[model samples]
Target: MKLNKFWATAVMASAAFCGVASAQQGYPKQPIRLVVPYGAGGPTDAVARIVGQAMSTELGTPIIVENKAGGASSIGTNYVVRAQPDGYTLLVVAANLVLNPATGIETPYDALRDLKPIAALANMPILVAVNPKVPAKDLGSLIEWIRAQPESVPYASPGAGTLTQSWGEMLAQKYKLKLTHVPYKGSAEASRAALAGDVPLLFDLGGVTAALIAQGKLQGIVTPGAARAPGLPNLPTARESGFKDVDAESFLGLVGPANLPQDIAAKLNAAANTALKNPRVIESIRSLGLTPTGGTAEAFGSFLSDELKRWTAVAKSTGIRPAQ
Candidate 1:
């Protein structure tokens, strides 16, 4: 009877432990690290900080925003892809997550396969920006001028594998323009080049160059979205600017190492959705010239896959093959 009782007690203890483990599986028992794979003050960093702060409140723990910028976001992205699949480490992936892989570059990690998307955070519209010295006042004049003197006009982008670079290439191919490609170390540098008139065009996210346009230091010819930016509703979209199919925007999202627990991912996605819905956070994100979007992991995953296929075709058509 003593032995039987002891065995029953062991079984009960195991069941109790299993219940505790199951309860713990609900997620976010500790602080989480949100890694922004870009320099501080960049668009990705700005969005990550805002979302991270609001999510911290919803999760009942501090969500730290860590800037890990370098190698076209590869260094930081690879760091997170290699992190433990636990919910502790998360990444703020940008459109470059898809563009980089399509560029045939030696990225440290594969975005679609190595990381499981948690939620989409925001979308930064791409703008056709130029310094005031460009002389083209609007999209039509700019197109005419570029068509007349394609090779003479040079454009700047954050890097070769970035969305800006991809857009510039696509624009060149679509319009049969001969714009020179000038890749900068980062978006800030590329925007500065446009501001200084070193580059005549900027095919980059509006968040990087919107202030210059507002201050009249730069001009916006078009944006690569179906609709004008809410911040600049007066500007026309690329489709309206005469290129009916030139719709593209830099999408931002959160992801973690692949194979993350479904329950943990669900909790994180809930917190992110809550964060994006915060009024103050929404205002901040819009002020940066982004449209906020927080949705299911499945939605984000599908979006990523579509982007990969779309940009891969873009790269192939633009002759952007992997460097030997």
Candidate 2:
């Protein structure tokens, strides 16, 4: 009886090994869902769809996109963080995934602790645009103008506790510009307000504001990035605009619930990287005023960590928090 039991246990171990190998060999046996933590047609969703399409071709499986927008992305992000660690459900999230918890109120999931970052898909700068009627032609003039009328001028953002508002707050403290903040439901509304001259200044994603600047509806002052964007070659960066320690850029990427299986993460990473290399995908990103950035899961994880640390300091210094 003892000999029979030992043989049975050995067979079970062998079967388990084979099962794991088989599972990895033909991974993603079904559709993969890529969740975006914002509404459809936004920059995050646009990139998610492009990358999802590329992944479908590379992985020989359907890649589905799901948008869950609200709570400044916490509602959707929390859903993915609590999802099964099978890698089937993924998130295409903006910088808010890291920024909100670090700078805003309580967050449902710890970005670094509850999510496994898959890749850094892109880094997008925010544009500092003003209504054409604003008495500022460029960065220097804008600074002077802001300095002159500290209390009267106000800036609009996608919402309170968002990157847009955070930049506004940081600018106010860094430059001592004392501009009031007007939060809108989203970038579209904020941009509209700026266009209508309701708000003289706005900090919004470059992709959304680039067209307006090109059309002469708004004037671009400086981009919140380490350097000028390729599409907006004439625009200066925050550093160049004489603002020290205020370089900010929004990155969009893919992340899954913490403890996702190693093999599954590897499979998705490979598929995503392959998709990123496609010429059409590259063109699409450039058209949206974004540069395609793709890399290993570890790199994105570190980027998120560094951003959280950086923004936490900004939030503390600027005294920014959710509206009462």
Candidate 3:
């Protein structure tokens, strides 16, 4: 009886190992779902569709994009964070991935601990622009104009606790600029307000304001990046603009639930990098006024760690919080 029991246990272990190997070999055998933690037609959603289609072609499988907009993006993000690690359910998230936690809010999942980075997709540059009516051409002149105001000057952001709002709040707190933040539902509304001069100053994404700058509807000041954004070459960088300690930038990336198989992660990373190199893919992302950025999963993981740390410190120092 003892000998028979030992043989059965050995056979069971062998069968389990074979099962895992077979699953990894035929990974993503079904349609994959790409979850976007926001509403449809937003930048994050747009990116998911663009990259999802390209990656689908590369993998010869259909990639479906589903929007789950709520809890400032936490709802959808947590869903993926708790999903199976089989690579079928993934996340295409934006800065809010880190911003939510950085704002000291309780999140359902830990970004650094619960999600595995797949690839860094693109850079969403933040443009500091003002209505043409504002008497300022650059950030320096804008500062002077803001100081001349009788009360706190009003500025618009996509929403509170966003990278745009952080930059605005940081400047207001650090430089003593009397600025009032006007939080909008999203980028489109905020840009409209800035265009209509409802809010004279605007801190927003480059893609939302790039065309307006071209049309002279808004005055381009500076981009808070290490280098000038490719879409807005003439615009100066915040570092060069003499604003020290402000290296603000936003990006989109892919991630899967924690403990995602290493082989599956590598396959998706390769597909993403190849898709980013395609001419159609590159042009599509550029038309959105974003720079295509693809690199190894390890590199993206490191970038995420740094971003979370930096944004958390910004939230702490500037006291920025999510809009209620």
User: What C-alpha lDDT values do all the predictions have?
Assistant: 0.84, 0.84, 0.88
Q: Model 2: which ten-residue window has the lowest total lDDT?
A: 98-107
**Candidate 1 Cα lDDT to native:** 0.84
Residue pair clashes in candidate 1? none
Q: Write the per-residue lDDT of candidate 2 for residues 222-311, one digit (tens) a residue.
A: 887876775888888877877667778888898899988788888888888888899999888877888788999888888888988877
Clashes of 3: 0
Worst 10 residues of 1 by lDDT: 315-324
How much is 286 displaced in model 3, in angstroms? 0.7
Pick by TM-score: 1 or 2, better one: 2
Give the per-residue lDDT of model 3 (tens digit) for 1-324: 999999999999999989987998997799999999999987788878999999999998999999999888889999999899999999997888888899977897898899999999989888999988888888788888999999999999989889999878878877789998899987889989999989998899876687888777788988887667766778898888787676778999999999899999999999999999999989988788888899999999999999899878878987788887
- Give the Cα error of residue 322 in candidate 1, in Å: 8.3
Highest-TM-score candidate: 3
TM-score for each prediction? 0.87, 0.89, 0.92
lDDT tens digits, residue span 1-324, model 1: 999999999999999978756865756777899998888987789899999999999989889999999777888999999998878999999876887778877786777889999999998888788888777877778878888872567888876667877877887788777887888876789999999888888877775577777677789888878568857876788777677877888889999999787788888899999999999999999988999999899999999999999899999888764323
Q: Flag regions of model 2 displaced more than 4 Å.
A: 1-18, 150-152, 240-244
Higher-TM-score candidate of 1 and 3:
3
- Top lDDT: which candidate number? 3
- Residue 84 C-alpha lDDT in model 3: 90
**Which pairs of residues collide in model 2?**
none
Q: How are the candidates ranked when ordered by TM-score, highest leading?
A: 3, 2, 1
